[model samples]
Target: MIRAITGLLSGIVFGFGLALSGMMNPARVRGFLDLFGQWDPTLAFVMGGAILAMALAWLFQAQTDKPACASQYHLPDTKHIDGRLIGGAALFGIGWGLGGLCPGPGIASLATQFVPALIFVASMLLGMTFFRLWNRG
Candidate 1:
């Protein structure tokens, strides 16, 4: 229960930070995406900060004897960047460029009840469902 509470609190904090920092705003994201034309680099700092935070968290986790949470991270480490992965990435880029909402912010942005965020979250869920069904079959 404590772990679940902590996770929820942490997620709320992160989402709030994203919103306060303007990272959750589609306009800011669009500005960042318009690189070749009137490029904005504010997103670079956000990305750098996320990378640093992840690195620090990983470093601490590596040295700790106990798990970060009462859970484990079971993930696949695929070395191959195959055509499917490339195609997915390209599609993701296009979606991000067009809608300015990735998974994280798209989910978080639901609090504001914005149309773009709603559409992004809806499509993201639909895509995930399709992928799961496709993979299962």
Candidate 2:
């Protein structure tokens, strides 16, 4: 129950931050990605802020033996980079470049930019489903 509540609250805060930072805006993201053209530096500040926050979070996590809501902290164990990682990253970059929205901002934009967000999210889900099915061997 506590874990679920924490997850929900974290998601809400994240969505709110995305909306507040103009990350929910596809044009803004695309503008930020546009290097040769009219590039926007707003998302750079947002990224920097996020990195700083996560750095603080890491510091806090280092001090804790376990999570407040759980008995243990769940962390990624993988350090090896393989084809899957590279392929997924390339695909994600392509999708983000073309659509101007990644998963977080894409999900957040569902409230404000419903139609486009819906399309993006639906496509993302479909892609995910296809990947799962294809890899289910």
Please report the candidate that would top TM-score against the real structure: 2
| Cα deviation of 123, candidate 2, in Å | 0.5
Please give each candidate's TM-score.
0.85, 0.95
Mark the 10 consecutive residues where model 2 has the least summed lDDT. 20-29
The parts of candidate 2 lying over 4 Å away from their true place are none
* Poorest 10 consecutive residues by lDDT, candidate 1: 66-75
Over 1-137, each residue of candidate 2 has an lDDT whose tens digit, in order, gives 98899999999999999988998888888999889999999999999999999999999999999989989999999889999999999999899988989999998888998999999999999999999999998
Model 1 regions lying over 4 Å from their true place: 71-78
Would you list the clashing residue pairs of candidate 2? none
RMSD of each: 2.0, 1.1
Model 1 Cα lDDT, one tens digit per residue, 1-137: 88899899999998997888787888888998787898788898899998999999889777876676666654477788899999999999898888888888888888885777788888999999999999896
User: How high is the lDDT of residue 57 in model 2?
Assistant: 95
